[model samples]
Every structure is written in C-alpha cells, then in structure tokens.
Target: MKVALKIGYEGTHFSGSQIQPDKRTVEGELLKALLEIGVITDTETADLSSSGRTDAGVHSVSQVVTFLTDNPRMALPRILNSKLPRDVWAWAYAEVSDDFDPRRHAVRRKYRYVLNADEHDISKMRDAAKLFIGEHNFSNFAKKDKNNPRSTVRKVEKLDIRSQGPVIKIDIVANAYLWNMIRKIVSALTLVGNGTRDIEWIGKMLDPDNYEEGIEPAPAYGLIFLEVQYDPEPEWMIDNYAIKHTNDFYTRESNRFLVISTILEQFVMQPEKGQDLD
Candidate 1:
C-alpha cells in the first residue's frame, strides 16, 4: 500500500527537510520512526518522497509526503505519531495511487514569510511585493541549486503583503519555488521597508543582467510551508472539513501573536521617548 501523509513540523530543531547523512533532519527522524515500527528495512527497499524541501529553521503547517509499504497491519497516523518527535507530527493519512508522486503531481505550492517589521514602513514593502507576481527568472532571489537541472523560471500566482500589527505576513502562491527564493524576496522587502532600498532595486534584480549583484538572501526562520494543492482527491482519507478546521486554527493563533506583538512594541517604544523628557 502507498500512503499519502499530511505532515507538520517545527523546523527549528532540525537541519532541514531533506535527509542528511550525519545531521539531524525531518526526513531522517521520520525514517527512523518508520523503521522502528518495521515499515521498511532501509532506503534501498523503502520508497518515500516529499512534496518539497524546506531550508533550515523553516516551519510547515501542511506538508505532503508519500511512502510505500507492503504491511497491511500498519495504521499509519497512529504508529508514526507514537514514534515521531514532539515537534513533528502526522496529522492525516490516506492510501494513494501507486502512480502518485508527491513532487511531480503537486499543482501548486504555497509559502508564507512572517517578518517582525517593528517600525518599518509596510506600505513600501507591499509596493515591492508587487514586482514578484507573475513569471520571472528568480535566479537572484534563490540560492542556485547546482544539482537541479530545471529552469529557474517559476509562475507566481499571488504575492500578497498584509500587516497584522508589528508583524508583516507575506503570502505567496506559486507553481514551484527555487531554493531560498522566499527568504531572498523577504530580504528585499525588508530592505525596502527600512528605506535602505528602493523599488528600482527590485527591478534591477529581476533583470538577468543585473540580478546576481543586486539581491541578498534573508534568514530561514521566517519562512513557513503553508500548503500544497493537488488535482483529483486521493483515496483512503479523513474528512476534508477536518483539515480545513485545522488550518483555521493556525490562522487564529497567528492573529493572537500579532496582537501581543503590537502591544509589546508600543510599550517598548514609549519608554525610550519618555527617557529623553527626563
């Protein structure tokens, strides 16, 4: 049987999503858990694929991963959750077609970058974000993966910037993303918001001739894997409404943090101004 899993993880503790030889990673931990439960003997026989690879310190709310197993006795979510780390959990599972490939079958991938802008100008950042919507060669915005043979041109369906108090959330939906693309875009927007870079700088980076010299990648902690979209629904799954509710809960939590952050920023800024009066 082939199972499709909806997985979530706090990437702060791991090296990254992909399996590393000696380093701790989400994939490594997951495989260990599976192996402990007798899911498969080793990588040579086990088949596993992830929707996408996230960089170190990035988090995921809904990540899709697929694995193959011949064991009929295994109850996926129950067994996997028991053996996995506290930070990583399997939320949902389903029997997918053997032909289904998590990476190739994915229609779209969504990513969100949450930034603590503090006193930065959000309006300016939004203006800069407009430049990212549409198809473009994002060589400047992503760390070139020397192993990847595919073209860097990606179609971005949406790029939205919204401010919830001191935190600026940048939501982007695209067919695919190159390595470090979201982080680099966030870095550019932050620089613009801080008045260090203008909109013209963004334009220059999009131009293939000038791109390499113009952009810098941001830190990895701010990015999150928001979701993955597929065409036809797969078989052997839980109710779709349950998944929707789970995502809604995440949105509520984000909003709650925004409120607290706004209050803290105001309190901190006021005391500094009061000191000058004294």
Candidate 2:
C-alpha cells in the first residue's frame, strides 16, 4: 500500500526538510526511523516524497509525506511515532493510490507568518496585504532557480492580515509558491506597516518588469506551514494518542520558552543589576 502521513515538526534544529549528505534534516531523521522500524529495507524501495520543502528554522504542523509500504500495520501513526523523534512525528495518515503525488496533487497550500505587533501600523498592513490577492508576477519577491526555471506568475486565493493580541498574523493561501516567496512578501508588508513603504510601493513591486528592487525575506522562524487543501480529501485516520503525544511535546517546549522569556524580561527591567561591569 502507498500511504500518506501528516507530519509536524519544529524545524529550528533541522537543516531543512530534504535529505542532506552530512547535516541533520527532517527527512533524514524520518527515513532513519522508518528504516529502524523495518518499514522498508531502504528508501529506494519506498520512493518517499514530501508535499514541499521548507527552509531551515521554518516550522510546519501540516506537512505531508507519502511512501509505499508492504506492511500497513507497521505504518500506523502510533507505531511510526515509536521510532520517530520528539521534534518530528506522524500524527495522522491515510492509504493513498500508488501514483498519488503529494506535491502535484495538492490543490492549495496555506502559510501563516506571525510578526510582533510592536510599532507596526496594523491598518496599513491590511491595506498592503490586499494588493497581493490575485495573479501577479512575483519575480521580484521570489528567489529564482537556475536549474529548473518556471513561470513566476501565481494566483493568491486569500491573503488576510489581522492583529491577534501582541502579534499580527498574515495568512496566505495559494496554488503554490516559489522559493522565499511568502517570507519576502512578509518583509514588504512589514515595511509598509512600519511606514518605510506604502500601498503604492506594494503595487509597484508586483509589476516586476517596470519596478525592480531586491527584497530580503523575513526570518524563517516566524513562518508556519499551516496546511494543504485537497479536493476529494483522503480518508485520514486520526490517532488521538499520537495527537496528544505531539501536543504534550509542544506544550513543554512552549513552557520552556515562556520561562526563558520571563528571565529575559527580568534582565531588561534591571539591566544594571544583572550586569558585571568592570
């Protein structure tokens, strides 16, 4: 059976999702676990593939991977999680067709970028985001690939900017994306919010041929691969136990970060007291 699994991972420590020769990566660790569990003798027999590649420090809660397995029982989410690491795990899965390609079959992909609301004009960001709601040549906003060139034109089905407490959330849904597309868009929108750029600048950026300027992408840590939408969705088998296990790991990590933030806040409040000045 060819099986698809919904994967989630904290990519901070990972080189990236793809397999790299010497560095640690999400796919490398995943394939190792699969091999240890006797899922398949090796990767060649399984023909594993992912929905898309995420850059280092970028996280994902809805990433998907598909592979062939002779023993379906060994591929269960709970069974798979037994060998997978705490940072990367399989939470849900489905038996898919042999020819189903996760990347090509995906109908739409959604991404979320969270930015600190401090000093940003939320209203202006919303205005800037609306400009990206349709088809546009994103050459200026994306990193071009030399090996395999493709059209830079892509349709944005939805782009929403909203303030959520101390952070602003930028949610984007599109048919697909180019390298560094969403991150660069975030940087541009942020410039508008902070008064460095305006709505007209955004309009000009979309017309890549007429207006040319390089845009640096926002930090990858703030971006999240939220989900992928598909037509005639698979009959996914949700593993409540696996979900709870993953939740516990995230909750623990969150608490650890919260404690560190509190400690940093104390230093900010009493910088001189904590400092060792000679």
Candidate 3:
C-alpha cells in the first residue's frame, strides 16, 4: 500500500528540501519522523519521493510526498506532527496508486513572490508581469547549470499580481520552472517598476536571439512554493479531528507572522519622532 501526504514547512532553518550527507534538510527530517511513526522499517521498504526540491529559505504552503508502506494502523499526521520540528506539519493524506510519483504526475505548479510595496512601484511591476503570460525561452531569467543545460523554454499560464497591506504579491502559475526562474522574473519586474527598464525590455529578454547575463535574481527569502495541482485531483483528506485543529493552528500562525513582520518593518522605518537626552 502507498499513502500520499500534503505538508507545509517554514524553510528558514532547513538547508533545502533535498537530502545531503551531513546537512540538515526537509526531506531528511521528514524521513526521520516517518521512521518514528513506524511507516516503514527502512528506506527500501518505504520508497519515499517528493514533488520537487525547494531552495533554502524558500517556504512551501502545499508540498506533496508519497511512500510505500505496509503499516496498517497508522495515525500518520498526528504522529508526524509529534516527531517533526515545530516548523513542519503534516496536514492531509490519502491512498494513492502504488506507482505514484508526485513530481512526474503534477500538471501545474504555482509560485508567489512577495515584494515590499514601499520599496518598489507595484503598478509598474503589475504591468510588466503581463508580458510573461505565454510560451517563452526564459534563459536570460533563469539560473543555468551544466547539469541543467537543457531547453530553457517553458509556458507560463498565469501571472497574477496583487497587493495586500504592505506587500505586493506576484503569483506565477507555470507548467514547470527552471532554476531561479521566478526570482529572476521578479528582479526584472522590479527593474521596470523602479524606472530602470521599460516594459519592452521584458519582451526582448524572452526572445531566444537575445542573451543577457546581467539579470539579477531576487532574493530567495520572499519566494514561496504556493501549491502543485494534479490531474483529476488526488482523493485525500485528513481525519476531521486532525484537519480541523491543524487548519486552525496554521491559520493563526500565519496571521501572527504577518503581525510581527509588519511591526518589525514599522519599527525600523518609523522610529520615535523625539526622545529625551541628557
């Protein structure tokens, strides 16, 4: 039997999502928690796999993973929560085909990059984002590597830009992404917003004939892996008890973070007007 899990994590403390020999990673911590829950006795038996890798400092709202297991009596979410660090949580699960591969089967992936509204021109950024909604070779806007030197062409289905309170959120939905693609796109948009580039610059960058190596990718901290959409949707649900409580906890946690971040920004940007001095 195999079970699919939907989880989320604050990636601030993790090296990244993939496993390495001596480094701490999301997948490594998850596998350890699985062991404590007795999902499988060994890696060979469990055969775990994740949807894809997330870079360090990148948060994920809905990451999916699957594993083969023989354990019948398993409280997967509850047990995983107990064993996992406070930042990671398993929210839902379902039975899936034995051959299910989360990465291969996903049809679309969505990413959201948040920028401080006070720092950039949100309206201009929104205008520039519209230029990305179609098939294009994103070579100038993606990080290239010898191991990943294949085609940089990819299709973007949607590029939705919106503002909420102090931040401007750019949500990009794509079939798949090349390394650092979203960040680089955001950097380009910011350049346009800040009057450093024109909207036409985005169009020219997508042309395969033009290659520019000066593209500055945005920082990884503000980007998030929003969710992955699968075909026909997977039949999945957490028991009512886990679902209700976990949802409540995550919602509250998110709001708390927003409040704290807003306060920090205000504290730094707007200090007390006057102070008594000896």
Candidate 4:
C-alpha cells in the first residue's frame, strides 16, 4: 500500500531536509524511524519521496511525504511518533495511489516568514509585496542552478504582509518557487520596509532582462514551509493523540525560546535620548 503523511518539524538542528552522508537530517531521521519500525528494508524499495525541500534551519508545519509500505497498520502517526524524535512528528496521514507524486501533484505552495517589525515601515512593505502578485521574471530574486537551469518566470497567487505585536508575518502563495526565491523576496521587501530601497526598485527587479541586481537571501531561520495544496486534496486522518503530543512539545520549545529572547532583550544596549556619550 502507498501512504502519505503530513509531517512537521523544528529544523534548527537539521543539516537540511534531504539526506546527506555523515550529517543529521530530517529525511535521515524519518527513514531511520521507518526502518526501526520494520516498515521497509530500504529507501529505494520503499519509493520514499517528499513534497518539497527545505533549507537548514527552515521549519515546517505541513510537509507531505509519501512512500510504499507493506505493513500499513504500523504506519500510524502516533505509532511513528513513538520512534521519531521529539522535534519531528507525524500528525496526519492519508492513503494515496501508487502513482501519486507529492511534488508533481501539488498545485500551490505557501510559505510564511516571521520577522521583527521594530524599525520597518509596514505600509511600505505591504506596497512592495503587492508588486510581486502577478507573473514576472524572477531571475534577480532567485538563485539559478547551473547544472539544470529552469525558467525563472513564476506567478505569485498571493503575497500578504501583516503585523502582530513586535513581529511582522509575510505569507506567500505560489504555483512553485525557484531556489532561494522566498528568502530573496523577503530580503527585497525588508529593504523596502527599512527604507533602504523604494517601490521602483522592486518593479525594476521583476524585469531582470532589462535591469538586474543581486539580492542577498534573508536568513533561512525566519522562513517556514506552511502548507501545500493539491487539486484533489487527500482525506487525511487526523491523529488527535499525535497532535496533542506535538502541541505539548511545541509548548515546551516555545517557553524555552521566550525565556532566551527575554534575556537577550535585556542585553541590548541603547542610549538615552538626552544622555551624552564620551
């Protein structure tokens, strides 16, 4: 039987999503768990694959992974969670056809970037984000592959910027993305937000054939692969117990980070408005 699982992970310690020799990775951990549970003897025979690839330090809330397994009963989310590490968990699953390819069947991919809104002009960033809503050549905003170069033109179905408390959230929906596309877009939008660049500069970037400028990608830690949409969505079986466990794990992680952030805030040096510095 062919099965698909919706997995989530905190990618801080992972080298990346893909498997690498001598490096700890998300896929490596997942395959290890699968092996430990006696799901499959090898990766190739199982036909393991994932919806998309995420860079190191980039997190995900909804990543789809598919594989062929003879023992479907042992592949429950909660069952898998028992052997999987705390940082990575499977919360939902579905029975998919043998020919179903997660990446090829995906119609839309959504990503979210959380950024500190301390000095950014939210209005300017929103305006700049709108410019990326339609189809355009994104060569300037993406890192091209030399070995297998593909078209840089891609359509942005939605690009929204919202502010909450001290952070701003940037949500982007697209058909597909070129390498480093979202991070570069975030870099450009942030530049506009911080008043380093103007809206015209963003417009010029879309026309890479006429105007071109290198854009450094934003930090991968800020990016999150939120979800992937398919034409005929899978009837995922939600594992309530698995989800509860995931929430518990997240709560612990959240509290730890909150404390660390609070401590770091106290260490930030700032001068008083009327104080003179020698």
Model 1 worst lDDT window (10 residues): 269-278
Q: Which parts of model 1 have CA positions greater than 4 angstroms off? A: 72-75, 239-278
Q: Score candidate 2 by lDDT.
A: 0.91
Ranked by lDDT, top first = 4, 2, 3, 1
Q: Write the per-residue lDDT of candidate 1 for residues 85-157, one digit (tens) a residue.
A: 8677777778888899999999999999888868679899888889988999888887766786678798889
| Residue 30 shift from truth in candidate 2, angstroms | 0.9
Per-residue CA lDDT of model 4 for 214-251, tens digit only, reads: 99999999999999999899999999999988898789
TM-score against native, each model:
0.84, 0.95, 0.89, 0.95
Q: Pick the candidate with the highest lDDT.
A: 4
The count of backbone overlaps in candidate 3 is: 0
Error of 4 at 25 (Å): 1.2
Among residues 3 or more apart in sequence or in different chains, the pairs in candidate 4 whose N, CA or C atoms overlap within 3 Å are none
The TM-score of predicted model 3 comes to 0.89
lDDT accuracy of residue 161 in candidate 1: 90
Off by over 4 Å in 4: 269-278
Deviating ranges (above 4 Å) for candidate 3: 72-75, 243-278
Task: Pick the winner on lDDT between candidates 2 and 3.
Answer: 2
Output the better candidate (3/4) by TM-score. Answer: 4
